[model samples]
Target: MLGAPLLEEASGIGALGIDLTSLLVYLINFTVLGLILYFMAYKRIIGMLDSRSERIRESLEEADRVRKESEEQQESMQKALDDGRQEGQRVLAEAREAAERYREQQAEQARAESEQIVSRAREEIKQERDAALESVRAEFAVLAVSAAEKIIKRSLDADAQQDLIDEVISESNAKQEQD
Candidate 1:
């Protein structure tokens, strides 16, 4: 009687069209296929993704380094340009100083030359004045001798004449000194 209840339960499960052996076989096949695909394709796909990520990271680092180098180059170029401008200004200032010195020297030279010309002209005038004074003194002595001869109304010897001329000249020099 116990076996009869067991057979009845088995028939009832069969009536629902369920096969336990085929279900176990299909489960085993699906598990084996999933494991094979994981081993062969999944690992390679993950490795490819990791390698691509590493390449992208390296490219970004290279771009950052290049940007830093370009910034450094630009700073150096600006410094060089500033230095060039300073050097040009210094050279221009030196040139201006040199020109000013040249102008001063030329002016001083002209002044010295003019002074020399003026000094020469003054010396010439003094020499001419002395010569004219000497000529006037000689003519005055001759006129005095002639006037004396007319006042005496007589001819004198050469010694007397010379003595008289010497006296008259001394008297004239005394009068000029008193005046």
Candidate 2:
């Protein structure tokens, strides 16, 4: 029964103009061509593609590393700039403080010198006043002696005149002190 179905199938294919031996030869040729192409060209093309892919990956990684390093350098530069600004401010503050201290010292020295000058002037005035008072007292005593000699109308002994003048000067001094 299987032989009969095969014969019928073969006859059907023959009516359609199909030759089995030629079809087999064509299939064998196609398989051989495919295998040759895979060995000769396909593997080399795949290897080249793989190498290119690896190079692209490495380039990407290197670019990322360079970018990170650049960022770190920029941060360091910024930090240095900030520190410099702070140092400048600190120096300026110190200079201002020193100037203020110098001004205060100069003021204090000027005040001390002025006080000393004023004290000397007052002492000189007091000494001049005392000298003027002594001169007036001596002139008054001489005038009193001349008046007493005229009243008496006689030349008194030198000792009596001297004693009289001393007594008058002492009385005046005592009165002045009481007043």
Candidate 3:
């Protein structure tokens, strides 16, 4: 009797295009394969994936740090360049000022030298004028004495003539001094 009912159930499942025992076997086989895969490969694959993800995150963090450091370095280099330019400008300005001062000093020195040269020239001209005047006075005195002697047609003794000439020169010098 139990066999008859089981055969009927099998026939019913066959009519539905299924065998219950084969379905049970397939379900058991699928469970075992799933367990095997989970124990043998799934955990390891997941672990590998987790490790890869961690490494990727670490790499991203490192790259970010490097980028930040590069930016800071670039900023520092720019600041240094600016400071160098400012210093160059300052040095150039100082050099220009120094050059201007040097030019002014040279000009002043030249002016002073020119003034000294001019003053020396004036002094020399004055001395030459005095010497020429003295020469002319001496010559004129000698000529006057000679002309008087010739006009009078009288000759004094040499000592007397010399004394008269001396007196005449002294009187002329006195007049010049008074003038």
lDDT of 1 by residue, 1-179 (tens): 33343223555556454667778888999999889988888888888899999999999999999999999989999999999999999999999999899999989998998888888888888888767755666677778777777887877888887887778768776886799
Candidate 2's C-alpha runs over 4 A off are: 1-77, 150-156, 175-179
lDDT of 2 by residue, 66-179 (tens): 999999999989999999989999999999999899999999998998888888888888888878766776777778888878988877798988888888888877876798
Candidate 1: segments with Cα more than 4 A from true spot = 1-40, 117-179
Off by over 4 Å in 3: 1-32, 155-179
lDDT: the better of candidates 1 and 3: 3
Q: What TM-score does model 2 achieve against the real structure?
A: 0.51
Candidate 3 matches the true fold with a TM-score of 0.67
Reference-based TM-score of each model: 0.51, 0.51, 0.67
Clashing pairs in 2: none
Which numbered prediction scores highest in TM-score against the true structure? 3
Q: Taking the tens digit of each residue's C-alpha lDDT, what string does model 3 give over 1-179?
A: 33343334544446454667888999999999999999899999999999999999999999999999999999999999999999999999999999999999999999999999999999999999889878877887788788889989898888988888888888888998999
Ranking, lDDT, top scorer first: 3, 2, 1
Q: Deviation in angstroms for 36 in model 2? A: 17
Error in Å for residue 113 of model 3? 1.1
